[model samples]
Target chain A: MDLLYQIFVDPFVQMGTAPDLLVQTLWEGLVSGVLYALIALGFVLIFKASGVFNFAQGIMVVFAALTLVGLYEKGVPAFLALALTIVVMLGLAVLVERLMLRPLVNQPDIVLFMATFGLTYVLIGLGEIIFGGDPKVMIADQLYLPRGAIDVNMLGGFVSLQKIDIAAAIIASLMVAGLAVVFQKTRIGRALRAVADSHKAALSVGISLEQIWVVVWFAAGIVALATGIMWGARSNVSFALEIVSLKALPVLILGGLTSIPGAIVGGIIIGVGEKLGEFYWGPLLGSGIESWLAYVIALIFLLFRPQGLFGERIIERI
Target chain B: MFYREAGQYKTSYAADQAIFPVLQDRLGLIAILIVAFVVIPLTGNEFLLQAVMIPFLVFTLATIGLNLLTGYTGLLSLGTGAFMGVGAYACYKLATIFPQVNLLVWVVASGFFAAGVGVLFGLPSLRIKGFYLAVATLAAQFFLSWCFIRIPWLYNYNISASIEVPTRTLFGIPVTGPTAAPVTRYLVVLSIVVVMTWLASNLVHGRIGRMWMAVRDMDIAAELIGIKLYRTKLLAFAVSSFYCGVAGAMLAFLWLGAAESESFNINQSFLVLFMVIIGGLGSLTGSFFGALFIWGLPIVLRNAPGAFGLSITAATVEHITFMVVGALIVFFLIVEPNGLARLWQIGKQKLRVWPFPY
Candidate 1:
């Protein structure tokens, strides 16, 4: 009976009694969720524009951040370093499209996916060699990202919120809104959607697959930069940030691989869900359930809807 | 012309269906086996025996295990490291409980535990496929890794939270544990890997393997043709986990002699996946080639700079190796999508038709 109470009832009762902790956990989850959403958003952009899964997105985040920090430490001004990083990412996109994608066109999905793994390896190697493999400060102060936390009294208790977290949430929303406008309204967006639907058909109608690929990859790169800045501000910018990319896997699948909004919603859901589970029921499980908790949640969701919440319904024909 | 298999005749069905129908191929296998069993040991290089050959064979087995699922059965798995961990931990638990039994038996027995866990995780495969399924498998990876750390019983309540192999003997020869001779450990690992690899070859070439291939090529179509999709996929999971389990057991007992959860983390899974892909998906021989390339190349590159009298730091060498490997992966994929095994086949083909363009 005591075991049952501990497993089922105790955590809820604790949440009710300490509502402030619940709110704080929720806020933390939302902030992390926004970050996860940003990463997943990068994935969705490339996956939508091209069928490739783009495993390099995580490494791209680390690479972009490293390039920025590495430049700053080398006496380059912050804004100039940022511009140079964007240019480098553009160069990377063009190179990838020409060298990797152009050669592997019409190949199986797994082939393209594995090629991205290759891209990931190259980026990691190059990033380490150029940046010297050390964690660096994100230069948040130089970039004017907010610091410190705000304490808000709610429901007769105080909830402390990181000012940087608020900035991250706002920046993520703006980026998403901006991406949505671009995807919906731009001529390139229409071409991208056409190419996404059918590569050959889009090409038949005079849409250049190469151009679209470069554009999509560049867009994904920009998202990675923004994600790096936010996440690196929270923690140190290093190769360890690559692990957070794996965290985005659950979010990407949960949100549906092709849906931008799904990425955001899925990221938030997984982010909040993981934090809540770890906080409320962690003691019963001996803590550290956060690692697999998101995957389990995604797995459960996948069981019911293999296509994901926002994914198009899968149709099979013989 | 010298390498050609042109005048071989098989008078019987059994002869026709022999694994090495060509006499030269059979001779090649025998020669390779002789080199592995007799030649390397005589050289008496402890580093080669312990570090290079043992781990190579261990990963080769793991790659074969993963190949059975991802390469043959068409289900991409990312949780191989965790499955291997299950085997390692299960073997540890079983060994501590029954010290009287021969350690090899426990090594094989540990596979059953891994298979059970694999099947449990694999249940989702019926509903999910592709990257979604791969992500689902990560649940097993992270969850099992957590269990390895959080559950003290897995390590027998060791303060270090790592499984330490207890010395075990086979016929009065110590085959495992810290005190075991490297040569003895190598021989035992080789024997296991060779036997299991032979079994894998037979399994892949037989009716069951065809069923697996059929499922891999098209599950819906395989279902229409009377192959049970769920059972076959689960069997692939079970068998794949079995190979990985044995590999993990050998890893702890023979190669590392001690291991923590970190040894079987996501990176291990990715490393094996790279081997399988770069070696050639769905090729048994490719597993070996992939293992040797992925495992051996870095070691070779790291030493080559030193040998060449270049003043490079170890970290710089590592970074260069990563770049080289990454570039090679892309290069291989671009040049021949089928991986190194395809290159070997092409080489043989070219050799057969030397001096003739066609």
Candidate 2:
């Protein structure tokens, strides 16, 4: 009985009168949603260019963040460390394309997908081996991001928002907008779309697919870094965070694998949904309901529209 | 040459139909079995036995499970870890409820629970395919993981919510828990693996296996040809989950001896999937060989540097191992999409045509 009260009833009772707690919960959800979308965007970029699911996006987040912090700890300036990290990411993109992706080209999608599984291990081993296994604090202050909270008066109560949360939302929006422009307007973007559509057609038209794959993978690495820093600022940087990346799989399902805007919308929905569930109705389930909430929502969406929010309905032909 | 198989012809179909057709392979397998059962138990170090061999045997079972679904049946799954947790939890629940039953029986029976869960989740496969199906399995992963943690009965109301293995004797020989001898535990696992892997191979080569292949090659055509996509896919899920579940139960009982909700997370699923891919999809031999290679490398690297008197940090060894494995995956993919199994096949083809151009 006491377990029920502590696990379920008390949390709900607390929520009924706690407007401030509601606002705090909403803010945290928004921050996490943006981070999830950023990671999804990494997945979306590679999927958009290569039509491969790019399972390595999660560890790329860990790898990029680990590299940045490890570089800084080794006496590189924060900004310099950031630049060096980009170079390393670019190097990795080239190495992957040259070493793995090129060989995997024209293979069955499953084989390529499995290759990413191998890549995941390589990155985990590489990341942990190069950077120590211990979780490190984000270089937030050195990166000039605000760490304080802002007081807000709303809904008949006072609420607090972390300045870092606000920065994360803004940065994610800007990055998404930048990608939207590059993919929709640029010539390289057109070629990537063409290749994503039909590799044979794209090749016959003189498009260099190898270049597009490398460029897109490198772009994913950058998004991964952005996600890493934002998420790391909220918690800590460690391989443990790799598991949370699986949550983005549901986000991809909700938003559609190939849509940039879909990732943002899906992120917000999951973020808000998880927060609301945990705050308002979590007590009903004895708390910790947020873990599967996004999946349940995605499941409902899949039943109705397997094509996703913005994706095209797949048509089979012989 | 020692490798030649001349004058070793089988006198009957039964002899030819033996598990290993080639005499040399038969001999090699016997040598390995002897090493595993006798040599390693007495001579191998703790790290070799515990870290490499035990995990290898367990994960080899797991890789076979995933390979049956993804590699053989042509279904991609992201929920393997959750199925494993179900197996582990089912064993926990069953043992708690029926304390009088033999421990091994409960562990084996736990797989049925996972098979049930797998079939339920697999219902989506009838309506969906490819990436959509993969995403659908994600639901199973999240839902099952959440259940393990939220349900108090799984952990017996422990504050930490972890399942601890209980001590038990099988035929008066300890097989699980702290007091069990390593050799006894290993032998139990080895026997189970041997039996289950044989069953999997038999199933894969039989009527059901061909039906699965027909469906994988072309589902609509297979349906037109009377292969029930619904039943076949669900059976794949059931069998695959059963294998994974048994491995998970054994993992919790015989290896870790204790586990939390986080014990069988999504990462473990991906790792198992990697083993199947790198091994050789559709080949049981590839399962053991791939598991040994991928799982064994770290141990070999950790030990080799010391043997050579070269001072190397564990981190450096780990990183180098990553680069090597990464390179090997690409090498195998480019050179042989069939994986290490294909390489082995090509070598055999060359041997059959030795010293001849035509």
Candidate 3:
């Protein structure tokens, strides 16, 4: 009976007793969800433009952050380092399109996916060699990201929110709105959508597949940079951050692989669901259920909606 | 030519159906088996046996397990490391419970536990396909890895949270644990790998293999043809996990001698997947080639600088190895996406048609 209460009722009772903690947890979850959505956004951009899964998005986040920090450490001004990092990401986008995607064109999806895995190793090796293996501070002060927290009184208690987190949430929303504009208003965006719909059809319509690939990859690179800054401000910039960024995979599937809005909604759902499960039900199982809870949630959700919440309905014909 | 199969005649279905129907191929198989069974163990140094050969074989088993699913049945799985962990933990628990049972028996039996877990995870594959299925398997990977760490019972409540292999004997010869001879362990691992590989070969060459291939080529077409997609996929999961389970058991007991949950992390899954891709998909011979290349490349790279009399720091070498391996993978994918097995076939083809281009 006690076990039943613990599993089924105690967490809710606790939530009822301490509503402020629930709100605090939800806020934290929302902030992290926005970050997860950013990473998933990078994935969606590349996957939509090209049919490739692009497993290197997580590493790209780390690499971009590492470059920003590594450049700053070399006596360059913070703004100059940021500009140089953008240039480097642009260079990387061009290199990837020419070297990796171009030659591997028309290969099976799995082959392209594995190629991205190779790209991951290369970036990891390069990042470590250049920046050393140790973690570095994100240079948040120079970047002028806010510090400290705000205490809001509610529900007979006070909820403390990190100012940096609030900034991260704002930045994420602004970037998404900007991306929505670029995607909706630009000629390149039209070409990208056409290419995404059908490679051959897009080519027949005189769309340069190569140009679109480079543009999409560079755009994704910018997203990775923004994500790196937000995520690094929250924690130390390190290769370990790459592993944590894998939280985006569940987010990717939850939002559906091809949907932008899906990614955002999925990220928040996974983030909030993960925090709630970890806070309430974690003790019943163990304290570290946070590691696998998002995946389990996504897995259960996948059972009912295989194409995801926003993915196009899959139709098969012989 | 020496490699010609021109004179070979098959008068019966069994003769035609033989795995090595060509005379040269059969001879090649015998030569390789002799080297594996007799030549290597008898003459190989301890490091060669322990560090290279045993790990190569263990990874080969895991690669084969994964290839049977991803390469054969067209189900991409990322939970291979966890399935292998299941086998290791099951073997560890089984050994502790029934101390007198032959350790080898427990190693093979533990595969059943992994298979069950594999099937449970694989249930999602019926509704999910492609990358989605892959992510679902990641759930298995992370969840089982968590279980490995969180459940103290899996490791017998070891203070260090690692499974330490006990000294297990086979026919009065110590085969596992620190005091065991490297050659003894090598021989035991070699036997298990060889037998399991042979069984895998037979499985892939039989009717079941065709079912898996049909599923791989197109599940809908296979379903229309009356091959139950669910049963085929689940069987692939069960059998693949069984192979991975045995490989994990051997990896822990025969190779590493002790292991923590870290040994079976997602990186291990990626490493095996790389081997499968680099070696060749859906080919048994490719599994060996893939294992050897992926596992052997680092050792070769690490030793190359010393051989060339170049002085470099160990850290530099490690980083360079990563870059080189990554570059080589891309280069190989670009040069021949079909994998090294295809290259091997091409080499044999060139030899057969020497002095003339086909």
What is the Å distance of residue B134 in model 3 from its true position? 0.5
DockQ value of candidate 2: 0.48
Model 2 chain A poorest 10 in a row by lDDT: A309-318
TM-scores for every predicted model: 0.99, 0.90, 0.99
lDDT of 3 by residue, A1-318 (tens): 999989899999999999999999999889888999999999999998898999999999999999999999998999999999999999999999999999998899999999999999899889888888999999899999999999999999999999999998888889888888877899988888899899999999999989999999999999999999999999999999899778999999988999888889999999999999999999889889989999999999999999888987878877
Q: What are the per-residue Cα lDDT tens digits for candidate 3 across B86-110?
A: 9999999999899899999999999
State the lDDT of candidate 1 residue by residue for A183-235, as single tens digits: 89999989999998999999999999999999999999999999999999999
The iRMS of the candidates, in order, is: 0.7, 2.3, 0.6
lDDT of 1 at B208: 91
Clashing residue pairs in candidate 3, if any? Answer: none
**Model 1 chain B weakest lDDT span, ten residues long:** B349-358
> B247-299 in candidate 1: lDDT tens per residue?
99989988999999999999999999999999999999999999999999998
Candidate 2 residue runs with Cα over 4 Å from true position: A1-24, A70-81, A141-144, B1-48, B158-160, B315-327
Candidate 1 segments whose C-alpha is farther than 4 A from its true place: none
Who is ahead in DockQ, 1 or 2? Answer: 1
lDDT score, candidate 3:
0.93
How many residue-pair clashes does candidate 1 contain?
0
